[model samples]
Target: MDVDVFVAAHRQEWDRLAQLLRRGRRLSGAETDELVSLYQRTATHLSQLQSWAPDPAVVNRLTTLVARARSVVVGTRRATWRDALHYFTAGFPAACYRTRAWWVPTALVFILATAGIGAWIAGSPEVQASIGAPDELREMTRPGGGYESYYSSSPAAAFSFQVWTNNMVVAGISLTLGVFLGIPVLWVLLQNAMNVGTGVGLMAAADRLDVFLGLILPHGLLELTAVFIAAGVGLRLGWTVIDPGRLTRGAALAREGRAALGMVIGLTLILLISGLIEGLVTPSSLPTWARIGIGVAVETAFLAYVLILGRRAVRAGETGDVTAGDREDELPVAA
Candidate 1:
């Protein structure tokens, strides 16, 4: 049958389905599945009929069908852990590649660090002094030394909460700074990066390399990685304003801002998990080798999920498809 003819016949059904979805009526399992199938079918039908000779009745039916095709949803169901994982994987990487902000933060960090190094080598005491820490609270808290003083009081709990809180603050600062477009965000990004590098340099200069590695390596990898991801989101958000494509700056910002929001939320979660590890696991009584192994495993799992499994899952959803239960399947199961 002609696609128009099919649409004309089902026009009323499409409108009614749209109403059911919009109204939040509980759809039987089969009904929900059928709606999903119909949505895909109708979208295709409309695209194919676009060039065909237009009939008023068929056109009217098509417009209404298209509206319903996009509008029908079972509503926001409770997200399972599986769904949250999927959302993070899809949301972050896609946002990264889709915008220039993905590279900007890292590039900016490199540039600033190089400039700082150049200044230091040129015998700028101001630069050297500025790089110097007023206090070595971090250095003083080492495994073999008095480094434990910072968390020694509360022990594991104190370290965990401190790391977690710091991560949260950094992520929030990156996201909020996005409002200034790339400038403010870049400023915050550089500050955080510099702090990390300077802190490590201080530890190294203190001749406490083992203490540094044992203290930071376990969770610093994840914690720092999450910070960069947050920076990426901020940069992307800033790009909309700085570039804005064909749209006005405000309009472009709104568009990109909406897309980047999910990434910020996901980054928050990443920071939280990192903090948990830094506070609890990083300072654990576990052997150095064991801590390294667990840290590597956590980092590996995150990478695999984001880069590999995440993409595969999305591809499967795209081609492999989901049944979601059709109208017939929705028929009540006989008691």
Candidate 2:
């Protein structure tokens, strides 16, 4: 953190980058590669000085240099379809896998809470009564009633879009709201659990639990898993603020925030698939087992995608963040 020593060490790389920037984009391939390396090093050094030393003159100069380097490096660069390919195949799943610690537990708790609430409502006449009048509950849970009619209420495509939008809103909130110490994410998740649990309780009370499962399981499995992932990511983001673990708070948040944003895009697509199942499969004349079978198939594939591809990507040094050129390098510190 000694300003003089820090500056002395990295001054050459900064000077070299500045020299390259003045070349007006006429550099050779080797020079271009060096420019990238030096730029990254300078960027990292600048982040450190600004964060740890805070010398106005040095920080400002390096900031300007890094910005100039970024434009030169990124301005002519284009993100191809390959970039998108890597994002889905590696970046997105890797991020999700890394969050397994957070999300796996999140899924478990949600399932437990839902089951527990369902049991309470189903067993306790008081809880069931509080939910709604007995007749209304019976009508809602009755076979071929509100629950079954819901999936067929709209055209399949339109219904899918609507369902996707609604679920995205929920998942988006779960992923983004975790920054507020994750409290809001917990609340959002709790509300979902309660709603599902209420349905289970009502269905069970009406002796139509199978009907409820048949309708929801068609899409609920994947849809809710995506939601759990978002909530888990959010909670982790909030926790990052508390124990950034060697990363400065700003650094940790920046890393996780970017990763969460990527998850938003990934989850958006995932929820769309679930919405399709909800709209098309849930209301289909196909046997209940077939519908549920389709849902289970996709959910299983998704987990495998995360566990197999995501794990491989993570072990291969992917942090689920954007590509190296797109992200900032953390400032290395001495112990």
Candidate 3:
């Protein structure tokens, strides 16, 4: 067999081994030794066969050998929970940092602006008069009257369900609205911001500012942040279509596609968790001080993660990753 053919066949076998290693599995020492021995033997034979043109039978045998190696790998494999999460989280930094400059700030700005405007209107008499009553939003705005009923009626489960339902609704709206890209997402954000701002402003105007703050701040902080993050991801995706860089639109999009998954997945987790937190804790009997402290911590942590930590992670990946002939670094072979 020609050395080149043998080398190529053997290289395929090596790749199979690498993939198995990465997949990971429990193996006895002797089993491992035997596999290694088989690997070395295959290597030697390929090396010997490479220089000379081998007959068809030899080529057939090499193909069979490679197939067998792959089978052994597949048979030995076991999926670990740890590896799945590792892949998911490993991709998070690259995903978030790459698009943060656009989405993060934009999301925050949208939330802040809408909330601010609604709050202002709530505070303004003429504007409030112009708008008339708070609309349906006002009915939902009351904590003790409407919100507390969920808890008062069914202390154990209703609050949790309410929090989950509300948070999920917000997240779903944010995520689905992302389809419209920046503008659609922006609209959804404004709607919620206004709802939140007006609701709170009305409460404060009614002289229940402390109570309103205490009721909403706890879970709203996390839920709102998660929605903003999701919006940011969608905005980034749309922006890619609108403003592709040096690369052709298609090429840049393809590149971004791989990174986009992480952001979406991460956002999914955030919403689910935030929903749970909102349903269970937002309507709780927690004190004002506790609520404020929790809100501050939630906001601060989110800012640090999305803006600071996320940035560092992406920079680290871009600088540290090697692109050249990293063939040997294929998936690790299981020990």
Count of clashes, each model: 11, 0, 8
For each candidate in turn, the TM-score is 0.58, 0.85, 0.60
lDDT of 2 by residue, 223-296 (tens): 99999899999999999999999778877898999999988879998999999999999999999899999999
As a whole number from 0 to 100, the lDDT of residue 1 in candidate 1 is 39
Sorted on TM-score, highest at the top, how do the candidates line up? 2, 3, 1
Instruction: Kindly give the stretch of ten consecutive residues in candidate 1 with the minimal lDDT sum.
Output: 326-335
lDDT tens digits by residue: candidate 1, 46-150: 544443444566656655765555555433345578866545556454554444347445756654684464434334434445654435433353444444444
Query: Considering TM-score, which of the candidate structures 1 and 3 is the better prediction for this target?
Result: 3
lDDT of each: 0.60, 0.89, 0.58
Q: Top model by TM-score, which number? A: 2
Q: In candidate 3, what are the lDDT values of residues 200-259, reduced to their tens digit?
A: 666665566677667677666766767766667667666777887865565455455445
The 10 consecutive residues of candidate 3 with the worst lDDT sum are 320-329
Sort all candidates by lDDT, best to worst.
Answer: 2, 1, 3
Number of the top-ranking candidate, with lDDT as the measure: 2
For model 2, what is the alpha-carbon lDDT of residue 290? 98
Clash-forming residue pairs, model 3: 1-52, 1-53, 1-54, 3-50, 21-332, 21-333, 21-334, 163-279
